[model samples]
Target: MVSGSNGDGVRVPSASFSRLSATNVLFGWTWPQLAVGGVGLVLLVIGGAAGFNLPVMLVGVLVMAYGLVRFQGLSLLAWTYVWFTWRSRLREGSNVWSSSPLETGRTVGVLGVWSQVEDRAQVVEGESVDVVGTPWRDACYLYDPDKRQATAVLTLKVEEWSLSTNARKRDRAMALNNLTMTLASTPGVVELKETSLLMPTSAPVPPDLDDPDMPSWARGDLAELWAMPEIATPLANVSWVSVSVNVDRLSTRSRNMDRLTERNRVGVLLGDIVQNVVAPALVECGGQHGSIRWCSVDELRDMIRCVSDPAHASSQRKVRRGEPTLSYCEESADGEYVTLESCVARSWWVTQWPDRPVPAGWTRDILQGDRMIALTHIWRPLSMAESEKDLANKQSSMLQRSRLADQKRLSRDERRERREQAQREAEQDANWPDTDHQGYITLFAPDKSRLDDLERGLRMETGKYHLTLNGLTGQQRKALATVLPLGV
Candidate 1:
């Protein structure tokens, strides 16, 4: 990083970061500026040596300087990861001030077809581009004609990531269905008067890989690779805005295949074109060709949090005369993703209804455990085994409560009165003090080295008995705490 006293006073700094932490790092440099700067510097230096043109080398020195400037401060880099909250399908865009903001007079229109492009103007710089609803991450192509240097920021506001084959098929089928109806209703456009479906009669028999007469019993070896997902070559040209990628064959050999489900196979494509392509090309186009999109600092912060923990949301809010509030909560898993679902009402969500919004000052259910008390929090899907276990525990708890109810034969109103009366008595009892004192158990060790082994043995024993425990102090009491568990 360099700070020239004669140049603009923008701060320049540098530091190292892990490789994965460095991808979203946004910075800009024009190839022309760098190339010109390089040539000028070399010519000026050589000219100085050869005695021809000192100014050429000086100009080259100025142009040759380029850098990857960190967009937002790296300290807050943790929240910028937004694969959550925002789905992978939604478009994302952001407004980045270049060395200068775009003046108001400029007007720009963007088109998708590559034939219309006139010059090499990148969109992420100068003015903003795309519709207001277009997300930051979905910046396919942006256009800003104003020239004075500015930044074309890449915003990542991911939308949906449900890219499974079933999802795609359903999406395509829905589109097809809508098209069918639209064509039938309207007369002007091409018509889908009729429709039919077809299915493959049989799986393609793969070529035998070994000796022709190898027994069918041993033929399993030949079918191994043949059973892999087949790749289909691209059929038509897709003219996407800003980016033009020729789609190749779609292959299923990329990811997990063992746990494959119907209506889908794992993702197959020519990289993340539908989502990651497009708008980025606008930024790359530069000049009047590019467009810009930006969210407020506060919205960007919330967006970052949402993206980082898609499953959990960290919200920012302000009330009329109050300090801004930051609240957090986890999103419910999609029903289709409930792998270990149990047929019981013991689900955390089932027990604690979600239809109602959470009240203020009540974050226990949101951040902590959703159980009766939340001391520790874990965000993970409940597998069927765990769901089953929860069901059993809930039934047992219900049985205990049922027994208590049965023991007191009362109507609904009477039961309520009785429960209230019992609660009051329990409260009264809690207020009363008890005088029973606990005695300490002490084990005297002949050698200090032996105490470590004794403590370890006692700790293991306590765990076996499901005994409550805490750290022990005083050598005598500590020794006793460990030894007593062994006996119990």
Candidate 2:
């Protein structure tokens, strides 16, 4: 595999097999599975001691094996909890109880007929007079009454580039490295919660029969070519990046403040991050960053409608519809645990990360599939002191594990490897910056059949990078919001 240097000058492999060790086997089993298996094993032992019938002993063994193999008891438990919660909501007969964090926050009711200000220069004046709260250059800002927080969604335009030439490839790689470093260093740049890259399934090109440059003979050929169903036409791809910044967490004030004050403060912070950090970082990376626009109430409603109701998407009727004033979303099904959506969506949690070094663009495959997918990376910043303490505790835990492994006569290689890893982590704690990150990917489809097809494609894509994804069964609604740019 080809190798390249990252911002830290570390040699990164283009692709490689992930590291496999004994610890992986233990980690593969969830706690619930382990507990179930343990109970089954105890039953088997008790049955054997009492000289119980062979059938009873066989049943116990089978239960133990099933628990070890399926590891689905936990998911079932989670679904049960969701079922009870839904029942309670039904009993209460109030919409106040919600599973989604997006709906739990303060209700401003629905503001109608919000409009986007196309001219960047008029943003400030627009906010002061006509706009609802604080007007951002690119994004719309809203105050969440429940959380006392301000949320903004910035739409960034991703510019496409060619990498066919070696020189172009090298330059792009360097640009990506620089962008990565910039993001890592930027303050208040927490997480990229969700990114949506959409490409139309089919595009049709009409023949220009009236063009004077075209010969009469060529016109018939062009018309025939345009009519051919076998030919594929290319369409422009659109991408949106959703990010959430915690206004309450960023504020210095201890007491509750006015909604307008909170809105303005959060708005300024979002603008600075976009302009000073995101925009400059993209420019250095041989790419251009677009204006950071806020999603107007109308825009938000349209988005929800498009995602929830696929008919609107397929018919393309909603494309030209002017943004509506207010929008509300409701899930179509409950308790079955698979189809959870304001429209229809399936959420997946990243169960495993690549264990070995991979190219910087390892995630590119995620966007290549035919289905609409949203990938989210949630980063939680850790203070230097907190990181150091956490590392020290981990080191202590590793040492104890190593000792236990030695006493149990486990593989010497595995024990030695654990010691080495602990040592490396100690060195890293002392030298490298600390950041905790979580990632989620959500797949949206029009129906169950489409969702199933997309899920298979996604699994194949993720497998290529040595990553693992597990469906977030009962937590689909929560996971969906978490993956969206709506700072839940």
Candidate 3:
């Protein structure tokens, strides 16, 4: 819950997210569970017809139990399937990737990632306004060939909470709420990803002290002093929001056009959404004009590189066109962490957020510091119809579950609290559309030896904020992809 006000002002905003309902496909059972249970039932029927064979009936009961039993939130059967899938991927060497320059016609620079970057400028927009005269010239879109989706990035300049007054913080919080609503209502927008990274600054090279006018002894002493390690300081804060447009959703009306034309049309629609829809919402958050703008091609590439390889983020090397944002030459996923050419990384999913209300910008503590950590939050917005249907189903399910609990004579206090929280959620949904959100945080290290220490520190840091991080032990590769800001 969050609220802010100053003397006679309206309450800013407050939200309750105490519980999340897991809606299943049929009668609170997933498809896999239903299928398995059906087979078990058939077996029991056969046993009954065969004079109630004790062994057969026992086997059937066990099978049903397997389908119903859950381990770490997954049914026993589903858990077994996942384990086998992970092993298969590992045995097939699919979890390992190594780039070979000698291979002919092989796609480089983050293979199996997004497709080429394409310009969204059109002839009708006027050639003069289409082209940009900056280093990362012209607005471009990252196209995913597999999904046929286009993603556009916007660089955000958020206001500092510490520097703002109480009234300003209240306004900013409301603006953030408005931003969330805008994203949910925007047409053709499938996902919104906000990525923030902090890169550490390295010690500066000693100045050229070999002056002919200076004495030799003094020059030597000065050089020695400059060679000492420099104090650590904050480097840079890179934040960007990527908005992905669903091409298939927008292409329905333009069936007669060719593929290229359809893609261009979708791009034009995305450009308008960014400019007219997202830009204004961002302006409110920043408390200033022009707080958000479309990221240029070069800037996007740099942002990707910074998240990909933090050690070299401050390098003076120019980001070339069509060059891959990730600089690693090899990547191997292990049981606990992933080994890359330049760094070792481990990913964690945020399983819990703060259960109680806290001040705004509470997350600043995690993002700040010299640690090499990146936090990516992905939001999949639901349309009005979808939101209404989902909420209705969830509310009904909650009430039914509550009734069952009452019949079982379960803990009354817990059930009552959950029902009240569900009610608050329903009321909130009535005011705004619903969005599915997930967060992933990845910590990078120079080598495997330092990974454990970093993980310990990260876990402790997150514990302070009541945030829980569950390490993705065997799914390191997938977790890495999920945490990175490549619209994964």
Candidate 4:
């Protein structure tokens, strides 16, 4: 493997040792483009046969070029329209109350204390329900009140280890390979809806640091730490991996089944997956499964209240404000998104993917930094046929762009970029067998100044992989919601 120096002068393994060739053509013109070109050709021939009318021939030529250049855009538009129409028709035909159960469903309320919820069913009065009985069980479930579909969510902590060295690199690779295999074996059994790794800023002292029994010297040090700027303040590296799965497929129950029965069934399935699949996988990766529990109603309510009103969260003097009194949020001027709790966060979408093949655990650096960060990955499964079609379309687009670059006699940098993109696409077609993946990273800090520092750290860390992150802007709240284990 080739090694390169990072901004800190630390030697890190390069993404790939050898460059892949991008001269091969994997796909040609798509069917839609061909059909449009055929029509344009016919029009051009007719105009020529009718004494070569300049306007008609010129229109035909323009139409042909448009069909060729904007083929992907037009095709995507058509596909989107067809998909919406089909979904609308299905909703109309079904007796279901809403188009999507996730959007309209009421949250599955959790009762009892955090310590009381366990992996096993808890017998209470006349009903038996599995409780999410652990402090680490930061998962929440959303229940469709109408359809009775239950979606269970659990956010497990992610552990970060060094990957720059050879031994650590090998370990990272094995862990990732094992994870991929485990996920693939599950088939349609469970869905890894979202995986988030967050590193929020650490508090200077424990919540109980104000005890009178504390020594004066220790108290002085604690106070100094607290007074330090967030950038200088040590960060608590916490990584959370949230997984969401639908519970309807776990059993052969009818759609009219009782809500309690459905909830119990889902709870059992989620617990089993955690104990059997998820926990084992983490153990194999040299990490322990921290907590696995369904999210409580109180926690969900608190989150909703905080997101809705930042003032309630930011207020120091707590007056009784009905339910969800302990709010934590800071809203932007427009009030679309909020700085949640003590963390000033901004979500980022991966705009530019790495052109080269990086080590499997390259994300370790991104997750482990002096500043708090959360990285979320959402994978949408696609059938084999769909994957093939999508790959073909991408290959064709890359080829078109490369040809265009050549025709335009673009600069060496531009040409190199096109070639690298094509090479990366080809590599993905050959190697990646998973579903379509979308990645988001959220950086958090105690305040705006710390947030800027965290952002800078993120940029420097991601620069090692040649990746670019663009802020989600107005969609920060939505992005944050995805990162949290809300099952929304």
Candidate 5:
């Protein structure tokens, strides 16, 4: 259920499951547009034949043109209609869609699915569910008021992670962890796709050029000159590389500043715009010389900060009547305070790894200085110090869980060893040669009834017993033949 009550209020609700309308997808436009066009065609052909004026005739032509467009099934709009028509049939009275409802809850919710004609597997068809982060992702919606944290971590019951020993499980874990956290915290997520590993698709990368003239200045350093198109080129290749993040894992570090009022959001809107959004444009601008460089997220933000004038000098100011002076003022940092560098190092830390290995000094600061951003990006909003704390907490918890699980497994192994030892001892006792070589004995029942009675009597005396063959002596075989009576 989408949570109803919480103080910060609803920013968004977790998908529980998101339903997508077929009409919203490609070819969904078919019937709706066709219906309009069909009526319009009737009007046009009728009006033209009925002696309407040139303007009316032009309107008729436009209507018929729309009908042909519907017939062509070329454009996105027409494609939607074609899809709808393909799914819809005149078999019965009701129109039907091609795909069935996907199980979202106890009662399945209908979200249309499709791939393509040649697609035998029917892969990558349906609504796109983008799993992204918040504050960093700017993806929150005002829906679920109570945002649950820590308790609600995203977990995929994956097949055993059969990663090679050299693979970086930690980085992969961290990346997935934070990606999950962001998507979980921001409840507006539609779907989650992993690619490159990309989820939801393995389609070819789309072209990023919105305009041929739009210069790109991505990568390089975070200086005034780094991202300007006047100096660099290749701005056309810029597309925001989405970072993965885990929200609940990071929420322990999420700071709830009473400072997030309407006024705060307004101020944050401009500054955050520069830091989070606008800085990328610089790198995307590329240089005039056709050089392309990637900027670490920090470098982009820092360079923007370097060029930007400070909002105000940190000064002691009078507090309002009810408000505490400490709330608005910057004080001497105590031992509890943390530095930004430490925070970034930890926040960016993922459980996954680099197969070969990158150097230890791979902070965004250092990467930015080197004018390189990682192929992957992670977004978190806390000050570097807070992010670091969250990272530490996540690691500590994971380690503890690992230890506990290991301990439990160790106990099981010990129990199994004991069982084997007991079995071995029992086997030795049974197989040990009787010191007295006790007299051998054999007994047989003459009939099935007698045999059942013997078996029952043995069960009464013994808990569990192993069966063995009686010695096949020639006399024993002759007696068995005689026991058959008439058959013998």
Candidate 6:
């Protein structure tokens, strides 16, 4: 975190996560680019050694061009991977998933058996959050037999920070940073996911209109104000944090145990981590005392149901474990968005973060809007050895880049990156674990036209902070998986 006094002399804490790696693996080229360019160079050298054959040299030039050219921030080879992946999905019919309606003509409302995604061993594919077991009351986990990992979801109710004093904000930020450090030091924690779900809620109870002295005109106007659409659909934001532990990483003894025994072991370990590490750290970070708890089996099911089918989000309906969460999900005919039952959804990759330092709560404006949206941050912690190696590579890359450019001048982006790297170095010196994170934004609408309008407005709003949102086309389903509170 970067803490400093603002123009008003209020000390506020701000932060910017590291973007995609800019370090060069070789001569200012990433691994993929370097490999492609190296092959081309080899071809050119062979042609030169063979008396400069024109055809061979031409092929070499074309290969080099292919390596250097980029389209939509991806090279030709990278695009090829995307194309094949999408094509395979199409062939496998993975893009469209529909559940047959029951006798009552209603589809399942909670995730359950789906033969299409089920493997021979009955494991659900692609970030499925199906709960495999609830070892005890108020403690449950989503287990992946293949990965031998179990993830526990916890509901976190943090203290409100809006309009809080500067000291409180600073303290909150520091406490959060401390929690991060604690997580980094803890072993067997493979990933940490924080998700915020913003939904439209029913209007709150209005003041009693039975006043004896109230004039008719005043009462009429007050009733109209309270009945406004925005007021009726007030925004409600819910936050969830999921921690994934590698069962095998925790105990090798599980390798010889049966699946049930292994799951039980994982459950016990997860409970311990939540009670000892996560719960305490969250409490210290201004979270309400006793407000953090592991989701029971039913709560987890309902959470997934609500996220998958937002129309049911405000209904407070009970979701059974044996029903599918989504009824009918398919990519739009234009491939611009996805339709999940009644809601039209679109997702974006947060390609850029604000270059200028902003407060830790800078996202309030975007998140507190009337529209329903979900912003997810997935963090993968780096071990100390891995952190040192990355830092060394970044330093080397920057030094080489400077040498290649004019000594006295640097580009604006270069300067900003240099400054950011300096801060990272300081963080490392302070034993703060380096983390790689990806940000995703998913927006929901009742229809395609509304979704389009929301997208346009959000683009403008995010641009104010120099943020970049790249629409995830042809991959909406996969991108949506990351933003869901499933620890994807």
Predicted candidate 2 versus true structure: per-residue lDDT over 16-104, tens digit per residue: 22122222123335576677778888888888888885776787887677656633223343455666766665465431222334534
Top candidate (TM-score): 6
As a whole number from 0 to 100, the lDDT of residue 43 in candidate 1 is 64
Candidate 1 vs candidate 5, lDDT winner: 5
Stretches off by above 4 angstroms in model 4 are 1-140, 144-150, 157-160, 163-172, 185-190, 193-234, 246-260, 289-322, 325-344, 368-370, 381-432, 445-457
Candidate 6 local distance difference test against the native: 0.71
Would you estimate the TM-scores of all the predictions? 0.15, 0.63, 0.80, 0.56, 0.18, 0.86
All predictions: root-mean-square deviation over Cα? 37.1, 8.4, 5.4, 10.0, 36.4, 4.5
Ranking by lDDT: 6, 3, 2, 4, 5, 1
Cα RMSD, model 1: 37.1
CA-lDDT, candidates in order = 0.26, 0.52, 0.64, 0.50, 0.27, 0.71
Question: Tens digit of lDDT per residue, candidate 3, span 142-207?
Answer: 666667677777787667767876666667777766777777766678888877766554446555
Global lDDT for candidate 5?
0.27
- Model 4 lDDT per residue over 1-488, tens place: 23555556545445442222222223244576677777878889888999998788888887677555532223433444544654553455321111223422332223211111211212111122334422223344554343334444443444455524555545544554456545544533434554544332323344446789999889988777767655344444433344445455554334333544545556555556566776666655545355433444444454333333333333323332232322233335332234654446677767555656675556767766555566776655444455456556655656576676665767654565556546546645655434546677876666777777777777887887777665644445556656654444
**Model 3's TM-score against the true structure:** 0.80
Query: Which ten contiguous residues of candidate 5 have the minimum total lDDT?
Result: 338-347
The TM-score measured for candidate 6 stands at 0.86
Q: How close is candidate 2 to the true structure, as a TM-score?
A: 0.63
Best first by TM-score, ranked: 6, 3, 2, 4, 5, 1
Candidate 1 residue lDDT tens string, 334-423 = 211001011000011111111222221122122111111111111112223433443344335444556777876666534543453344
In candidate 4, how many Å is residue 449 off? Answer: 6.0
